[model samples]
Target: MKAQTANGFPSVQLVVVKNGRMIKNSAYGYISTVDDFGEPLMQKNKKPITKETLFDLASNTKMYTVNFALQKLISEEKISIYDKVQDFFPDFKDKKKALFKGKSDITVEDLLKHQAGFPAGAQYYVNKKITQKKKTDKRQNKEIVLELICNTPLIYSPRTEVLYSDIDYMLLGLIIEKVTGLPLDKYTEENLYKPLNLSSICYEPLKKGFTKEDITATEIRAVKRTKDEKFKDIKYMPVHGTVHDPEAYNAMDQVSGHAGLFANAESIAVLAQVMLNGGGYGNIKLFDSSVLNLFTSQGNFFSQAGLGWRRQGLNNSYAWAFSQLASADTIGHTGWTGTLTLIDPKEDLIIIIFTSAKNTPALFGRNLRGKYEGDFYLAKNYGAVTTLIYSAFKNYDNAMLDQMLIELAVGRNELINMIPEIYDNEGSRKDLTAIMESIKEQSKQSAILRKFLKSEKAAAILAEIQSRNSKKSLAKKQAEGQSK
Candidate 1:
C-alpha cells in the first residue's frame, strides 16, 4: 500500500474469493489529496477510500454491457451471436458504407471477439463544433458519433485478424438499444445488475444519486479542447464522479458500451462469482450455463480471446495478474483505469484489484518500442500483490512445488539477472541466495526433480543461472575498477 501510494495512485481496493466464498476484502489509501487542478488540498478535506468507493471501470464495462447483455438476449432467442451487423443496422449496406467493403458480413460474434476489423476508435470529441453541440444535447451527439463510425473505413478485411476496437462494442451497445428499446444502462440494470442485486454497479453513477465523495477522482486536466486548438482561459479541474475515457465522457456523457461503468469491489465480486457459478448467483440464473460457456470458450480464430473476455494468452499470460499459479482455464480483463478481475473456474478463484491510477500524473501512452506502457504504479503494485497472494496460498506438497519449480526453471537465469536491477543491497542478495539454496535442498528428495534433472528444462535452468551469476561478478569487478 505504501509503495503504491508513493507511486502516485491514491487508492486501491482489493477482493479475493474462492469457491464462492469471500476470502479477503480490503481497502487502502485516500480517494484523492490533489484537487481537480492537481493542487494539493488539506488532508482533512480528502476522503479515505473504502470498500464501497466507486471507481470508473472504463473498458471493464464491456463485460457487463455487451457480454452479459448479449448472453441474456441470446438465451431469450431475441438475437444470435452469428447475426450479421448489417441485419440490425441496414446503413452498412447503403452507398455511404462502400468504404467498409466487408463490413456487411461482420457478425455480432465478430464484434464480441473484437475481430470486426474496425479502427480502434475515433476521437469524435476532438471536433470543437461537435463538442459544443454535444454539451447541449448528448443524445443527438451520440447519433452523430454513430454516423462517424459508420462512415469510417475498415482497417482490415473483416475477421482477418483480431484488432480490439471500442467501435465494435459501441455498435453492439447501439444494437442493444435497437433490440430492447432501452438504453444500454437501463437494459443492463434491469436485466443483470438488479437481478443479481449488485447495487453499486451502474453507469452515470452521479446521475444515479452517487455523490462525488462516493467516487474516486480520475485525471486532472484543464477544460477539454479541440484537436486543432486550445481552450482559452479554461482552468484545470479534477475529473471526479465521472467517466474518464475521453470519448465516453465528452461524447456520450458517462454512458457508453465500451466504457463508463462505475463500481466498487463488492459489486464486482458478485458479478465474478455469478460467472463462476455458471451464470447464476444463488437461485437467480440470468442465463444458462451453456450460454456462459459459449461466451467464455476460446474462439476458433483467437485462443487467447473468448467472446468478450480475455483468456490467458501466452505472451500476456495470467501470470501478469493472477501469477503462475493460475490455471489454463482462467479468464480475466484489465481496465485502463487500473482495474483487474481474474476468475479461474478450475481453481474456483476470483481476484479483483481496483485502483484509480489515472488520477495521478502518469498518463497512458506508448514507449519508443511501440509497446503500450503507462502507470508504473499499477504494473508494479499489481505484480507484487499478486505474487504475495499466490505465495500465501502456496502448498508445500510435491506436486505444487514441482509446478512452481518448472515455472521458475523456465526463467531461472532471467530471474537471477533481475535481482541486481531490483535490489541494491548485499543483504537482499544474500537473502535471495539463501532462498535458492533452500529450494535446491528440497529438490534433492523429490521424484520429479530426479526425473527432470537430466532433462533439457533442468539443464537450461542450471546453465542460465550460472551464466547470469558470472556476468554479475564481472560487472561488479568492472565497476570497482572504474571507481579506483
Candidate 2:
C-alpha cells in the first residue's frame, strides 16, 4: 500500500469506492515508534498495516450505541420512533428542572438527531460526582456511569436545537440497557457485529494478542506525563494502544459510549457494507430496512437525522469522498481518532480511511487545520463542477442563477451541510450547477423566468460565480501544465 499526507500529517490507509465496489485501497506510513518516555508502542518493525489490525474508533461508536437502541425497539413492538424519553424514563421528566424542564418533550428521535439540546460533552468524567474507584471486581462500569449521567442535568431543553452530545448517546445506551435488560455491548454484539462478520470490532480494550502495534493510534491528551510543572506545558504526544479521548475513556468507566469501540479498516468496511445493504447482509436482517433508513433520514426542521447514523445531503455533509459525487446519496461518520467512514447508497459503496497521527500532541492541536483543508470535498467535486460554474457565467441567466443559489442553499440547509463560512466559499460550485439543473429542467417557464428576472444583477452573480470558478481552472491548468 502507498501512503500520503492528507492534510500535512502522514496517514496509513486511504480507500475509495464507486457504484458498490472498491476503486482504491492503499497504505502508507510507519506503525510504531519509541516514545519520549522510552515506552515503545506500535509495531517496531516497519510492518504493513492490514485490514484486520483493529483501530480505536473513538466517537464512531455512536453508530453502534444508536443501533443497539434500534435493535431493542425492533424486538419489542412497543417501541415507537416518536416515543419521548420521559415516557420511558419518567425520572428524567422532573429530575433536572433547571435544564430539561420537561424531559417528556424529548423523543428517542431527538436523542439520535442531537436535537435533545444536550451539550456535546458533559464534564462529569473528570468531576468528583463520578467515582473512578474499582467497585465490584467483575461488574461492568457503564451501569455505574449510566446512573451518574441520568442524575446529571440537561444543558438545554429538547428539540430546540441539534447539539452534538455523547452524553445524549450515553443516556440512550443506558436506556437501552434498562429497557431490554441487557448490556449495550452484549446486545450490539449479538445483533450487529457477529452477523456482519465484523470479527475485529470490539468494545473492550485489547488484551494479550493485540497491542498498540496492532492498531492505528489517535489523540494526545494532557495526562500524567510529568511530575514537574516545567514539563506540563507540553501539549499532545503520540499515544498508541490506549484510548486517548478522556470523554470516551471516562464513560467506559474510563471507556465509553461516546468512544472506545475499536476495529480495523476491513471490519469497518464490512459494517459500512452491511449498512449499504439496508440492515441485512445475506439472509439475516440485523435491522429493518425502514429502520435503517430512519437512522439515515434527514430531519425536517433540522438538516438530517433518521436514527443513529446521519442522513445523506449537503446540510449534513461531513466532507466524505462519496459526498461530492454528482449524484451522491452517500452518508457516513467520522471519528475523533482520525477515522472516516463514508457510504454511498446510490453506489452501494463504502470508503474507510483511518490515520494515527492524532496520537501526537502536535497532531492533536493541528486537527482543525486538517479538516479545513477540505481534501475530501476537493477530491469529490473538483473533477465535475469546475466547468459548470464558468458556463453559468458565460451566459448571464438569473433564472439559472436563482436555481443554482436555491439548490446550493438547500444543500447547505438540508443535506451534507458544511459550516457557514466554508459553505459560503465552496457551496458556490453546487449553487452554480443547481441553477443549470433547474433551468434545464424548466423550459416553458423560461418566458415567466424572463418576465420576472432582470439582466444586470443576473449577469453580476454569474460573473462573480465565474470569477471563483476561473481561479480554480487557472490553478488546475497551471498545475497540469507544470506537471508536463
Candidate 3:
C-alpha cells in the first residue's frame, strides 16, 4: 500500500471478508491533496483516510443498487426478467421520425445482461449530446436523457453482443422507481441498505450530510471525456464527494442506476455477504435464495457475466479485481473510480477495494499510466492482494495457484506490449517491454522465489508464495529459541 500510494492515487480502502466474517479492513492515504478545482491544497488542509470514508462506487452500483432492487422486485412477483422494458413506461416506444430500431423487443433480462444494444455510454453532462436536437442547461433533464436513449438507434441487435453499458442500468433504475413508486435511492435505502444497517452507503453522499473530507475525490480536475467542441468549457472543477460518472451526475442528478453510489470498503463487503448468505445477511432477508442463484450464475448470453455481476470464466482476465484462483462461482464487478467487489458463494468470501484512481491530474490523459498510477487501478496492477487472500485458506489447489501466477506474469508481458496508450513513445514502450521480458525469463529459469517483479522483486511475486504453507517449512524446528 505504501508503494502503491507512492504512485498517483490519493487513497485506497480494502476489505476482505471470509466465511461471512470481516477478516481484514483498512484504509490508507489522504482525502485530497488538491481541492475541487485542481488547485494545490496545503498539508494541513488534507484529511486522513479511514475505514469509514465513502468512495464513488462508479459501475459497481449496478450490483449493489440496481441488481439488488431488481432481485427484490422479482422476489415479490412485481416484475419478471422476461418482461419487456416497454411494458413499464407507457411512452417507451420508438420515436416517430428517428432512426431508432428494435426498441420493442428489449426485455428486462437483456438489460441486466447488457445485451440490450445500448452504446457503452453517452456524455449527457455535456451541453450538446449527439442524439439531442438542442443543448439544454448545463445538465440534462432525466426525461430528455431517457428520450435520447429511446430515439438513438440500437448500436447492434439485442442479444447479439455482450457490451457493458451504463444505459442498461440507468433504465433499470427508472424501472425500480416505476414499480415501487419511489426514487432509486429511497427504494434501496428503505429496502436494502437501511435494513442491513449499511450506514455509509448511498447516492449523493454530500446531500446526505457527508463532508468533502469524508469521501475520496475522483479527479483532481474534471476533464473532457469527448473531443466535441462543446466539451471545451473550462468551468469544470475537480470532482469530490460526488458521482464521478458524467451521465449519472449530470443527467440523472447523481442518483442514476448505473453509478452515483458512495460507500466504504466494509459496507460493500457486507452487501456482498448477502449474496454469500443466500440472499440475506443475518435476519434481514432482501430476497429469496432462488433470486441469488439466478442472478449470480453465468448468463446464457455471456458466461463471463451473470445478470449484473461479472462471473469467473474464460473472459475473466479483464477483471483485474477478481482472482483466477477463486472458485469458478465467483461473481464480482469493478468501477471506473477504482472500486472492486467480488463475492464467491462457493468459498464464502468477499473482497472490496475502493480507490480514487483518477485522483491524479489528467494532463496526460487516459491510461497513460492508469495501472502504473496505482496498484489498485488498471492493467499494470497484477494478481497480488486477491490472490494472496485466496492463498490464506487451506482449500484451493496450490499448484493451480502457482500456475495462475505464472500465467499472470506472462500476461503482463503480452498485455503491455499490446497496449500502445500506456507508453509515452515507441522508445519507452520498447524499454518497458524489454524489462518485462527480462523478468519473465528470470522467473522461468529459477525455481527459487528470487526477484520476480520488474519493479519491486517481491511485488506480486506469487510464484513461490505457496511454499510458506508447505508442510516441509512448517515441520522445521524453531531456530535459536530462547524459551523452548
Better of 1 and 3 by lDDT: 1
Please list the residue runs of candidate 1 whose C-alpha ends up more than 4 Å from where it truly belongs after superposition.
6-8, 42-44, 94-100, 132-139, 222-233, 313-318, 363-374, 378-381, 396-484
Q: Candidate 1 — which pairs collide?
A: 36-237, 36-238
How many clashes (backbone N, Cα, C below 3 Å) per candidate?
Answer: 2, 30, 1
List TM-scores for all candidates, in order: 0.76, 0.66, 0.77
What digit string (tens of lDDT, one per residue) describes model 1 on residues 140-211?
667777777766678777877788899888889988988999988999999999988788889998899899
Per-residue CA lDDT of model 2 for 119-200, tens digit only, reads 7876665654344444544455565565566566667766666787888777777667666687767767676778766667
Best-fitting candidate, scored by lDDT: 1
> After aligning candidate 3 to the native by TM-score, how far in Å is the CA of 447 from where it should be?
14
Could you say which candidate leads in TM-score? Answer: 3
Decreasing TM-score order of the candidates: 3, 1, 2
In model 3, which runs have C-alpha deviations exceeding 4 angstroms? 6-8, 42-45, 95-100, 127-140, 223-236, 314-319, 363-372, 375-382, 394-484
- Regions more than 4 Å wrong, model 2: 1-10, 17-19, 33-46, 68-78, 95-100, 131-141, 220-222, 225-238, 314-322, 326-328, 363-484
**How close to the true structure is residue 120 of candidate 1, measured as C-alpha lDDT?**
89
Worst 10 residues of 1 by lDDT: 365-374
lDDT, model 1: 0.73
Location of the lowest summed lDDT over 10 successive residues in candidate 2 = 1-10
TM-score of 3: 0.77
